[model samples]
Target: MVGLYMVPPDNAVVLSVDEKTQMQALDRTQPLLPMRPGQIARRTHDYTRHGTASLYAAFDVATGKVLGSVTQQHRGADFVRFLEKIDRTLPRRRALHLVLDNSSTHKTPEVTAWLAAHPRFTLHFTPTSASWLNAVEGWFAQLERRAVRRGSFTSVSDLRSELRRFIAAHNKYAAKPFVWTQPADVILDSVARASRAMRINSAGH
Candidate 1:
């Protein structure tokens, strides 16, 4: 996994793909207080739930560009459509190396058939409960901090619009290749230790 980040194959594009599911379209009950000198912005405690959106996003590791879509459901069909969108965006000649999580939608027969047909595309799933390894997860964190969190959305359409605008701005100005600093051995050692501790605790129990 570390090697995939640090030293990807030549002529191949690495993409970190994932979904930010069930994002609420929340409308604040009261108007928010504007920020003033020596004071932070404040939002209303109460909110109305309009609906939810499922965001499927892909981050190009080489160019740091983001490609995303908002969907009502996170089914295998939805995932396949997202992958098709990605396929259309990328160059045909270059191989696609996608790093994603082991979600059920990802491994479904529909997704499998699509991958089989597109031989140039490859998938690498992150370890269970370790989605932090996928670079796209960091992008999701940024989206939450800068766009979603504390923002008021009266409906699902409003939320989707905000997300699209945020992604556009990010790709235009903030996009940059993510650098992997930790060595593979160091990461492996930490994982091993954590696994050992878990095993010991389980045995004790």
Candidate 2:
């Protein structure tokens, strides 16, 4: 029942964790050139089909710092590895409140058993089908549009290196903390309006 505005103490850490799936590891032979005015750089329409990678990200709300990893698999072990990465990123003596989706791997008996031993940590899950509540979702969306989309890499390691570099650059200019707009009732009203419009269109059809 942790609320979105529940701020972390100065000595504690709050992390929003999420995993992005089916990320293609594409290879483009041509270098990405800058486009001139009224012109666009052209590249091959098709890309070499390399394998996919699972990217797990963790965002610290207080510090605006993000830690992430691109893994070959998205199993429970990989998820555990991401959690460990979060631990390494945060201050050691501090407590943590982790916000995440309720995936099977996240809530499995194995993960639960491990969590039981870590009393300093608390895991909170977003409601079903509402993972947008996790701030890391927005972080991944930014990473996707800015770096991952339509980009090329020579190898898996090359892609990882590029991601690491991009992350470092992003951290250099991290913006203000995210501000949630619109009150709950206003959001619900918007949804209701959309639903009414949909009903009207359906009746006409």
User: Against the true structure, whose TM-score is highest?
Assistant: 1
Compared with the true structure, model 1 gives a TM-score of 0.89
> Which sections of candidate 1 miss by over 4 Å?
34-40, 191-205
Error of model 2, residue 170, in angstroms:
1.5
Residues 133-194 of candidate 1 have per-residue lDDT tens digits of 89999899999977888789989999999999999999999999988778788877765765
In model 1, the clashing pairs are none
lDDT of 2 by residue, 1-205 (tens): 2344344566777778888887777897666667889986656656776777778877777667777787888888888777777767677799988888878989767677767877777888766545666888888888888778757976777777767777787777874465557676665565466557757777999
Over 4 Å off, model 2 = 29-44, 184-205
Q: After superposition, how far is residue 132 of candidate 1 from its true place, in Å?
A: 1.2
Whole-model lDDT per candidate: 0.89, 0.74
RMSD of each: 2.7, 5.3
Model 2 TM: 0.78
